[model samples]
Each structure stands twice: as structure tokens, then as C-alpha cells.
Target: MRPSLGRFGYPKSVRGYAVQAPGAPTLDVFSRRTKWLQKERAARDAETSRKVDYVRDEVAARLCERLLDIKRHFPHVLDLGANACNIARILTRPNPDSYSAAPVYEPLSSRVSALTAAESSRSLLHRDEDLPFNNEIAITRHLLASDETLPFAPHTFDAVLSSCSLHWVNDLPSVLTQVNNILKPDAPFMAAMLGGDSLFELRTSLQLAEMERRGGIGIHMSPLADVRDVGGLLQRAGFRLLTVDVDDIVVDYPDSFALMADLQAMGESNALAGRDVPPIRRDVLVAADAIYRALHGNDDGTLPATFRLIYMIGWKEAPQQAKPLERGSGMVSIKDVLEGQRTGGKSGNR
Candidate 1:
């Protein structure tokens, strides 16, 4: 007989692993920002915020391309992150009325329509906690919510999209499960999040410098999920027709300090609970800066920072989607195929 799985089908030993453990306090490295409206502060930070939005715009555009390729119109869409409602703006542009369900009354030049548009951080919104839109594009609901806890009915949306978010989520699997539950069967769910390799140059430089200056390294960066883990995460969350891809974006900065400044403006600075209680030592920071320049410097005297984005596209599971074949259902043997290849068949041509 086969060995049975532990709770949640995770191995018993793995139950203690931070990534696999459900509701692990240690894994909650990111907490809701307690600062005074960080999003507003970021907006005022000038070019740094624009640089972060450049990445977000790329993610939003890629997601919109996929959505458009699906061809079928989505009557109801959900924007999970909705930071400045970028995704909705992309979808509704070209012609907002092309997507609107209503007949001509007055041109809805100031609004667009959506089933739900939610922002995890309320501070990201403008005066009324909403985007400035034409009357043509009206959002039915503007929710101040997080991915970890989506307050919506099950099978509620025709399509769902998230951009430049989900990397901050601590319990990724649980949030994915919640995302799955709210999506209608066969509906599309698309997201882009930073992958494990993001800021590797910075992380390595800091670690090496810290170990040399101090005795050991501290938790300077939050742990991010790898591209390899995403496919399984989608399947585990009851999503099929799964597709995952990686996009590596590298940006150059004047120095490590410049890079750190941009990260702060992006609101993506380290937030690990177990990070060093004391402030980082000046010597360690100085050493790290030197190391980063020495290793990653460019001809322009700048340094490159890599942002690895993992894009995921999945559909809520339904009977219509393709299924894997059952065991022993193959019509041809692998051994026979190999023999044919050796005997001057198809495989010999290459």
C-alpha cells in the first residue's frame, strides 16, 4: 500500500517547514505596513515611484495581453492588487464603451465599470480611496482588502488579475486557495510576482559584507518563492490549464545607496519579523556598498539590480479542461520508441 499523506497532503516532516506549514507565525515575514499612508509618500517620492510603476506597468501589460488573447469578453473582472487600478485602466482603454454593458445615456468619460476593484493598501488610493476615472468606467465595488483575506463570494468573477503584488504575501498557498475559491469555474486568474532571484546581487553583497564586518549576516531581505514552486502552488490551489513563466528585469542605479532608495520608494524594503533588532552597523553598510560596486558595477559606474518576475496564468478547475491520462494508458512503449530510433527512425534525423 502507498503511504498516506499527512494533513493537507504535506509530508509530516515538511509540516514544520516554514513554507509548507499553514498559519506559521514565523513565516509571516511581512505585516501590514503601520506607517502613515505609505502609498501617498511613495507618490511624493518623484522618480523612484515612477521607476517602480515602470515594472508594474510591464506586468500589467503582459497580463492584459493574455486576457485579450483569450478573445472571449469578460463581463465581470476583479483586480486583486488594483494599485492605482493600472490593470483596469489597460483593459478599459482604447474604448471604454467597448466593454461597458449599458446603452448610451451620457458618455461615461469619467468612469469605467468592473465587478470589483480591490487594493490591499488603502493608502494607495486617492482622495475618496478610489482611482480618478471617467464616468464611463465605474467600479461596482472598491474594496480595501488583502490577498490573504478576500471578502467576496465564491465563483464571483469572470476573470481576475494581480500585478506587482503577491510577493509580500506570507501564506502564499492559503492566499492562492482563497483566490481559487472566489474565481468562477474555468475563469482565468493571472498574476505576476517577484521570484526568488530578485535582488540576489544586493542580498549576496550584504551577506558577505555583514559576515566580514560583523560575525554573521542578518535577515536583510524577505524570502521569495521560486518559479519552480508556482506550478505546484496553482495545482494545489485547484487551478488547472496552468502556465508559468519568468521575466528577468534588470535596472541600473548609481550605486547601492540609490538602489536602496528606490526600494524604499517602492515600499518593498525588508519587513522580516526576525530581522536584526538593532540597526545595521555603519561599517557593515559601508562594506556592503563597496562589495556591491566591486561585483556588480557597470561602465557608467552604476550597478545592476535584477528583478525576477514569475508570471502565472491558471484557470479555475472544471470538467471541460484537459486531464492527465491514467496510469498504464499509454498506447506505445518507450522501449519500442527507443528501438525504432536506433533503427534509423525519426530520432536519427536530428
Candidate 2:
């Protein structure tokens, strides 16, 4: 079992870990977490992204060719937290050539109606059940809400592709276990999730200001777990062909408050279940905004909010002869490993 952590919880990047409340206290000095939200964020994520429908759909289109190459014979697929059903939308509109890499595409999603008029689906399975599809299912962005475990059979899916999810979950190792069990030998699993440094400005500013105002400290923002952390997770999860990539998009906002509102709009709020909940008074909120502007704002009074995204691609291992190395040693060839340039971590291990 992992070691116990206090109110701030554990993640490498969390700067201020103050449990005691600040100088001018506002609300009750929140000792324990109040009523639990019961992992209710899933329903909220579905409802909010309708306005951003095109973004997901466009993501699918961009990955079409690469996704096609991952599997042959139209492997059974499952799209998780499939709010927009964008994969189905792109599948129907195949390239000009009559022949493509995929066979009959099956989209099993929660919001069944979200599938475009042109797309097809096998069945609608609940997120907490054994998927309706027999084997070789693909999923994305579904189980990352609150570290809730996934339900599926071992060695099931031929390949899994997840786009823009997994940042919210804390049970990285458990999630990887489910992935390894459900995926077949040597099957590919690729995903895109926000990285630890991903919304640095937005996350750090909020955390610091909260610390400064309330004299209390706990991770207030939705802190991102980094790429190395993810790569290590994949290794522990039993994936062999592992590759993690980042796409850092620095989004500009007029003010830090505007950026904070955008986070709410995206339904990506902090959900540290069993965390301390101190009341944030009106003045505290006002002070936080000012400090956020002071630290992260640019010369023209605009704040730079970084959205560093990580694209990870890994696969279950096919049976091979084992040539054991030293405990901390690797059998990998160095030249072949520098496949892509990456930041952070010691050398190019990730």
C-alpha cells in the first residue's frame, strides 16, 4: 500500500502543503472533508462540453490515419466518456480511397445518441460493468474522473486509444492494471492527458494565492501529474512499447480570473475526495485574482496560461525470451530510444 499523505495529498509538483489556516480566517477552520460529492463529476463533464463539440471531432479526424494503422480487421472499439461521439463521426467519413485500414467500426458509448447520424454502434454499456463487446475493446477519457476502477475482462482488447483524458485520476497504477488485463499481448494503447506542468500558471497562481490569503494550504487547483509519472505508470501497468509525448499549448487570457472561469466551463474542477474544505471568503477570492495577475500576467496585463498536453503510446508485450539484466539495468539500445525529443526526467529514460 502507498504511504499515507496529509491534507495536501501527494504529487511531486505541489509547492505549498500547509494544513493550518491563514492569518485572517473566514470560514470554519475546516478540519475534515464535509459531505462527499460521490464521484459526481462524470455527469457534469458530459453536460458542459456540447459547446466544444467540434474540438473533440476535430481531434478524431487528425488521428484517423494513425488510429487506422494501430489495428487491422476493424478491432472491436469502446470510446469512454464519449460525450461527443467524435470517433464515430470521423469513421463514417473515410478517405477518398475505397479501401481503408479498418473494418466495421463499432462505437460503444454512454451517450448513445451522441453518435452522428452516419456512425454505427454495437451496444451501449455502462462504465461500471463488463463491456458488452466480447474482446479487443478500445476506450478513452472515461475512468479519469476520480480514480474509480474500471470493469473489464483480462487480455480482452486488441488495442486501446485514449485521447485527452486520465489527468483527473489518482489511481494511475490501478488504471494501468485494468488496461494491461483487458488488452491482448503486444496490443497498442495510446492516450492523451494533461501533464503536471500543463496549466502551470492557472494551477500555481491559484494555489499560491490560496496559501497567502487563508494561511491554509492544500492543493486547491487540479494539479497535473507529469509525463515521467505517466511513463512509470505504464511500466508498472505492464505496457512494453511505451512512448510518451507532450504538446504544450500556451493559451493567453486577459486575466487570471478569466482562466479560472474557463476551467469551470470545462468541468475540470478539483475533486480531492476526503480533502479539507476551508470556506473561501469574498476578499480571499479578490486577493487571489490580484496575486494571480501579479505573478503570471504579461507586460500588457495579459496572463499566460500553459496547457501542456502529453500524448502517450504504449503496448502490451508479446511473449519473448527474457535476458535478465542488473536490477536497475535496461536491455534497450540507446540510439533507437531517442525516437523523440522530450523535456524533464533524468536523461531520456522516459
User: Which tens-of-lDDT digit does each residue in 235-335 have in candidate 2?
Assistant: 88887867787676676778766666665544455655555566456666677678768887788888887767677777777876233366758677564
In candidate 1, stretches whose alpha carbon ends up further than 4 angstroms from where it belongs are 1-27, 34-48, 92-115, 127-136, 324-350
Residues 54-168, model 1: lDDT tens digits? 6676667666656645656566788886766666555555533343565542322123235467775554533233434433465654656554788879988877888877887
Assess the local accuracy of residue 91 in candidate 1 as a C-alpha lDDT between 0 and 100.
58
TM-score on alpha carbons, each prediction: 0.76, 0.60
Number of the top candidate by lDDT?
A: 1
Q: What is the C-alpha RMSD of each candidate to the true structure, in Å?
A: 10.1, 14.1
Please report, as a residue range, the 10-residue window in candidate 1 with the lowest summed lDDT. Answer: 104-113
Clashing pairs in 2: 21-215, 22-214, 22-215, 136-156, 136-157, 136-158, 155-181, 156-182, 196-224
Number of backbone collisions per candidate: 16, 9
- Model 1 scores a C-alpha lDDT of 0.73
